[model samples]
Target: MTGGAMDVLPAAPAAAAAEPEADEEADPPAAAALTLSPADSPPAPQVSEPRAPDSSRMQMPPGNPLLLSLTLQELLARDAVQVELIPEKKGLFLKHVEYEVSSQRFKSCVYRRYNDFVVFHEMLLQKFPYRMVPALPPKRMLGADREFIEARRRALKRFINLVARHPPFSEDVVLKLFLSFSGPDVQNKLKESAQCVGDEFMNCKLAARAKDFLPADIQTQFAISRELIRNIYNSFHKLRDRAERMVSRAIDNAADLLVFGKELSALGSDTTPLPSWATLNSSTWGSLKQALKGLSVEFALLADKAAQQGKQEENDVVEKLNLFLDLLQSYKDLCERHEKGVLHKHQRALHKYSLMKRQMTSAAAQNREPECVEQLESRIVEENVIQTMELRNYFSLYCLHQETQLVHVYLPLTSHILRAFVSSQIQGHKEMSKVWNDLQPKLQCLFAGPHGAPSPPRSPQDGLSPH
Candidate 1:
């Protein structure tokens, strides 16, 4: 391409020289006017299409085979001229067009056209920043706002389609993009998604209400319902903010209840002692205290059995409740730490988002009105930041309840279970020890005689084993 490029010069006079002779001896008027005809044209041969330009127009350096090959290939190829301009590195003409490659050498261009542009782009990005290189003269900035709008609309549609394919993305981002565009089609799609989320939120609210009828001691079931309600409430806000008006009011109302209810019903403490009014009666308390002491002399044989069984039940319930409370506290601490992180990220995102909103508002009211392309583009970026912040907020609450492991459900439920066990132990002991110590001896004597001999035991199969 290089060797052949040198033979062609931009100053070559063939085009001019061929014109006059070709026009001579023509009819008087035609000849005087400098028009040429078929017979008088050059003999190299002519077809309907224009001939390739003379090689002299293309300039090239000597002895570069690669460049030569490129030039020769271009000569034989038809259609689509190639132009290359290589700028100098770290020099006065760094950004100027130093190497001009025309159609004559383009057919054998080394890089694929698209890849070629990228290569140049990367070079420009690196070099143009640090060097005082010459740059092309400026022209008008972004003419034809409508053309750009059409282009942006297509681009945004494609982007939304791509994002929809990913599960993790929040729909709030999608709707914000649509709202910013204010295009009918985009708005319709956003509205549809909002409706779906709105429905889910409503269903969660209904389920939560139903759970309120359950007994207070059944804490786990209620906790599950409440957590569900809270999740839906968070989703409702995110969707509502994005313009999901169909169910917006409903979701908003539900959210109000869920949020405020949680705040109002918030546990004073993760733990509490047994209620004071639940204390045992005086007679039962007396027996309980005696049981606590060594009862070997009065009820000698049954002393260890009663004490061990009663103490075991008390120890089991206390141990389980303590473990549950400890876990609840740990989870709360972790949630607080996470909330701090969310708050920090939210601050940064909101700052950027507000700046974008201000820019858009200013741009919208201008005399010419900023192009929809730029407005939508800026909104796309800003909306991303907003949605990210919102998601962070949702995640903070999600962690707050430790919903991933269902701890909110587990903690309260464990408390209820412990209460039931404690009540059962107190009631059972009261029933079994109601008789006085002397009454037991009287009963035994009535059955046989106070001095009567004991009855012989039956075969082992006649009685149940303790275990």
Candidate 2:
């Protein structure tokens, strides 16, 4: 099999394109175009008249060699026997040995740098938008250590296995070329094929209509998640701000109490009689002032620490939620692209089939050239095959999307759990405050002597006077 074997032939030139000459006959009364909607009732299988096999007909060449007699399970039986990170002057390369069940029949080694994998994954995503392309490992800035390389090696193997298991994706020309070719040839072929696929996808009319084909329920779910995430982020932000303000006020009050205690101590023994509720021994007052200052400083430090931690935690949650939303959006976009490509191809095939059928009927009536009629018949067969494949690809994508929705349900549930957790923590803080308030007076009384005057009730304004 030649490298870069395309599954579908390139589109014929527009001018030379085969179309029933409209003037030849009134356009065969316009029949309804085939509807490829996944939700629609399945069409009854067509039964064709039995015919003798024609041995004289030439055998068609296979489009892709990887599709030849290889089951997905058989391909996946190949294992990564050894993985190594080889350091080169330019950078690092990941090398691995693949051993098939029959070692003698199939054993090979492959090498790919990190960037190569990244490029390959991107191309795969573009080419097969509906397929669940396994995610690459997160990017690491630092050079590969043993653990990092080992983890990446395992991830890469899993990714390869996933690709191999997917029938349509496994037969992708780029993937086959990448695995079998080496050096510059692999890179060149992969790049060329990627560009071709990309260009074809871009030109597809279905791309424009892809969003319309999305299930309404999925769209609604996405909208709900987006709104929920936004609300949670804003609510948490506001809660963080209010908590900080309350902590700030408490610290200010503590400082004021410390200052008022210092003033009372400065009044001295010769001072005019202090209010019975306000009088205390100077030594006692001094100790109280020091304790207040210490407690105030400690509370301030704790508040700062708590505020930092709370903010950090809130940021992390919001980030994760946003990431989930982003992932959903990305998946939808990929689905749209996949649907567009498949639908576009299917439509084109339908168009060709219609044209050929009309042209063949007209040619037969006019006793026209047999060669032209044969060509038209051949095209009809080819278009039918292409249309069948496209339909299969379309339905597969639809099924995949439906399965993915099950996974998407978790996003909103996770958000709800996180929101409840935050609320519970806030409630816990409120309960702690109530407990502290109930204990404050009892704690103060423990420090008072039996003959000593009771301390005046502290007010927010009491201790804030400047020296």
TM-score of 1: 0.24
Worst 10 residues of 2 by lDDT: 8-17
Give per-residue CA lDDT, model 2, range 66-105, as digits (tens). Answer: 1133332354353323334555443256433222111111
Residue 71 accuracy (lDDT) in model 1? 28
* Model 2 ranges off by over 4 Å: 1-117, 123-128, 132-292, 308-320, 373-381, 408-412, 419-454, 458-467
Pairs with steric clashes in candidate 1? 1-67, 1-68, 1-69, 1-71, 2-67, 2-68, 8-55, 8-56, 9-56, 71-105
- The TM-score of candidate 2 is 0.41
What is the RMSD, in Å, between candidate 2 and the native fold over all Cα?
16.3
lDDT of model 1, residue 30:
10
**Residue-wise lDDT of candidate 1 within 37-140, one digit each (tens)?**
34322222112122233322223224431111232123223222333334433446332212222322123222112222233223322311111111111212
Best by lDDT: 2
Enumerate clash totals for all models, in the order shown.
Answer: 10, 0
